[model samples]
Target: MSDLNKLGLAEARDALRKGDVTSVELTESCLKAIDDADALNAFVHKTPEIALERAKAADARIKEGDAPSMCGLPIGIKDLFCTKGVPSQAASKILEGFKPEYESTVSQQLADAGAVMLGKLNMDEFAMGSSNETSVYGNAVSPWRRGNDDAQLTPGGSSGGSASAVAADLCLAATGTDTGGSIRQPAAFVGITGIKPTYGRCSRWGIVAFASSLDQAGPMTKNVRDAAIMLETMCGHDAKDSTSAELAVPNFEAMLTGDIKGKKIGIPKEYRMDGMPAEIEKLWADGAAMLKDAGAEIVDISLPHTKYALPAYYVIAPAEASSNLARYDGVRYGRRAHLAQGDGITEMYEKTRAEGFGHEVQRRVMIGTYVLSAGFYDAYYNRARRVRTLIKKDFEDVFAAGVDAILTPATPSASFGLGEMTEADPVQMYLNDVFTVTVNLAGLPGVSVPAGLDAQGLPLGLQLIGRPWEEGDLLNTAYALENAAGFVAKPGKWW
Candidate 1:
């Protein structure tokens, strides 16, 4: 209890239960940490008032002996999730100053369980970028920096703020949405744990949409156990979301027995891409060795369509984004463009979008629109959908052949310095998702666990892809890996 801000979510929960610490004290500690870490720009909006009020109420619930486990927990919410009157811009100017009258189902459920919201963390505009640089406010700097270097680093995006905040100890944990490796990639880059649940495992209602089919909400936490606890609180079948699965909620924490004996973990040979760094390759092999030592059977497998995952994801995600973002054309809500005396509605839309969106978001919107156009719909969008089906089948076939989960490198490299990837070629930036897009394309659950560090001392993560709706078993496997890796390294307080 000496440094309340440094406690992990599980530790803080226990402290609150033992009367060793009060919810209000823990909330204040986190608020102080948030204020001190402003240089990182993790929390775009601070909500100390709402957080303290919720903490007091949570204390009352705990005193009544009827509180849930998450009750009295102080947490950070991603800016993408609508939280009553809080600003929920997905880091885009198009939705500047827009606050929903209601809350997203995921946030509402967390509130119902007595989790206090510290504030909305920043993210890529409309969850479009790999680095958090696309945010309208500015980039969320990673707490981790290269040895003896002052250069700013990315915390991987679009969940960059979530990863940064959790890594910097600004909050116990934070909510993050993954479209194409958003949550897992950022978590991996920051040396924390993040899990992207199976698509539709968490409700999408009220959360800003990027890709209707691929977008899913999950937790970025300090460890796999914390992720298991948080994910249970965030998931449920929502009547408002047609895609939300109708299923019984399982206690994911209860299933983390760390006993993967006889479990078959697949090593997709295609993941060994040519020119991948020696560190990443060694880290992946080390991760597999750890799992093998944990009594899990390591099986060499093939995901035949793995090579097409990135292209298919780019096509499908953008296609869905164009359709979803059409509502933001200087319309009913959000920022509107000024009009000239002779200008008409079309001119207003053109000017508004041009000014509202960032370079990355606009690029994606244009690509999406082009593919969905009548002249190229079949050639681009239709073919991408076909490739998507094949990617899903690749996972289905692997699992059908007794593979419990798939293991691979989370990112091609460790966190890179901000501004390193100039616009010289955008494909270089897109390659960050090479290993992660397959999970989103397959609509399967994937978790990134901090495994090792590179020569520069930056953290590297190993990803574990699980069967759909089998997150409990997946957490168990991740727990085993986490224990074996024993990665407790933290970033020096450069921020």
Candidate 2:
């Protein structure tokens, strides 16, 4: 059981049940890994005391013979999730010292299932950036590096730390919420698996709001099986979240039979953007061939409104974010800026917000406010809403044509240097979400599976977009791809 931290979720679960290892040992192993990997800036807050206590309880639970599948496993919680009495900053300065008295429903469910939380992992400030550089805790560096190159790269955002931690084996898996491609992009960047369940499939209660309509929590794990095992525990109906799906929790792990024999996987033509790297293009073609070899039908499909997804997302997400973030005035909890003697409440509000939010968050809030303003509401917000409908309809039309899943490149490119995109026009950063925003707009299930590596040996992933609420089928399709690709490359231990 040496290097117990490297075991995937299902592996650790079975090992604990078989008495081959104890939860405390696994927790300690992960804690040690987390401590050693601070160079990556993944785990922003460490909770070793709480983790050890929970591990002891999980060991006792396993001994009782009625343990759940996640019992006695260690995992990381994204900073977006509020753990009872733990710092839940969402990686922004505004919520710096705010600790919730209650736990987020998803994290609570995992805790109830006997999963030990290592700490709050870092992310983009308020889940607003494509790269991890915008975080108050600084960038969550990717564990992966370009072949023989020493440059640091971003793990992808908002959920950057989760991807870094899971890929580095600092934890067996981590919870990540995807507003756009926060979960999937990072998963792809770090050469791991991440799934964003259909909107409302997982409870959003207690997770900091970042575009309520698009935010859905899912698992970032080392493999599809680990994702399945973790996702099953993280999902279900929660009355606390109006957006949470009221559906039965399927046994997702059992659904991974890896038999996509007669399934139809759509290859969206619109995903073939101009200037797409030849390496990415080749990797995509190779992925389609692999799926075809697995006995799946690869049909050409059209999501015509794909080009409009990014604009629609930027508009609608920022609009919702502006409204959601308005609650963080100096009056309530979280950080409050120091005020002058003559400062009124209005001045206090203005000063606190300007100081608290990061540049990216401020930029989005302003854009949101401007769009929702009376003069431009119809021209911006309303039009964007209409475009969102068209985007959703595009997927519905494709699915009606009997497409079980749509396959596309998860990211336009592989992991880039830490400050690469941010230095140029901010739009460059927005382009990173081009391949992923559509799924969020359509409220569909999408999973990113590491398919192959690029020329520099950096990992590239292929996304499997599923019919709404059909994550099981999507995951099974991804399982077929995973087996075909046989991608087992782990980043060399540079940290």
Candidate 3:
């Protein structure tokens, strides 16, 4: 138990119940690891005092013999989550000094179940961008490196910091919000497991809004079992969020039998894009082969509308973002720009937004505003909404035809260098979400499991898209894939 920080959530939970380790030990180990790994820039805020106090309380709760499964585990909270008295900036300059007096429902649920919060993690500003470079706290670098190469690599974005922290064992797991591929892409890049549950599965109240319709919070963990444990604790019906589902939260961890027998796994033909890397293609095929070996039938299916997903998502997400971000005026709770004597309210609004938002945020806001404008509403926004309906129908059709799950490559490539895509056309970066945006668009449950490595020995993942509200079954399939892949390769600890 020397490196208690490296224990996964399930592992730590069992150990705490068996009286083998104290919560304070686990918290201290993680705190020390966090302090030593500042080069990764994964954690933007540290809460060692609160963490130690919570750890002690968790230890007492465990001794009472009626503790929950997550009773003594230490985990990281994404900056998007509003933790009371903690800096929850969403990595944007507009919210520089913002600390919430209330806690987000998901974080509150975890706290109520006795999970200790390590700190708030870094993320892309307002959950924009595919890489972590847009964060006000700077980028969160991947713990993984190419074979014998010294170049720094991106940990994917929006949920980049959560993926990095879990992969590097700074915490047992972390919370992640996925608008497009924020959770899954970063998990793939860092060689971990991440799931974006079906829309409305987790409460959205208190999380900084990016895209109201697409945003869902999930877990990033060391393995499928850890993800299952954390996800169960994070989901429930919340009256506070109108979008929250009113269904019963299943015991996701208990459903992990790692048996996918008789399950129909679909391989979407449209996922085979031109110019997709040979390594990715091979990895995807190999994943299908593994699932077939696990007694699951692999069937070829068609999601013909897949080609329109990225563009439609780009239009719709930005439109929602433009509306959601309008509330961050200088008069609000966050940072306000200094005004000159003659500045009117309109000028104040313009100056504050221009100065507060990052470049990517500004770009998306502009795009959103243009699409929502009266003249173009019918042309862009309405058309994208119609396409989104078609996209959702495509998935419903596939599922109605008896497909239990669909498999695709999680990302087109492995972790790229940190500054590699910033100078290129922004569309080059948007292409990174090619394989993942469809899940959000369709409001389906999607999980990324590390399947194999590329030529440079960096991890690549295969995604599983499950039927709506069937995350338990989806996680069972993911557990099967996790066992089949046996992906236990951790980074060599360069940090």
lDDT of 1 by residue, 172-287 (tens): 99999999999999999999999999998999999999999999999999999999999999999999999999999899999989999999999999999999999999999999
Candidate 3: lDDT over CA atoms?
0.95
Q: Which stretches of candidate 1 lie over 4 Å from their true place?
A: none
How would you encode candidate 2's per-residue C-alpha lDDT over 130-249 as one tens digit per residue? 888889999999999999999999999989999999999999999999999999999999899999999999999999998999999999999999999989999999999888889998
Candidate 3 residue 477 Cα shift, in angstroms, is 0.5
Count of backbone collisions in candidate 3: 0
Q: List the lowest-lDDT window of 10 residues for candidate 1.
A: 1-10
Model 3 stretches with alpha carbons more than 4 Å out: none
Which of candidates 2 and 3 is the stronger one according to lDDT?
Answer: 3
How many backbone clashes can be found in candidate 1?
A: 0
Cα lDDT, all candidates? 0.94, 0.94, 0.95
Looking at candidate 1, what is the lDDT of residue 401? 98
Spell out the clash pairs found in candidate 3: none
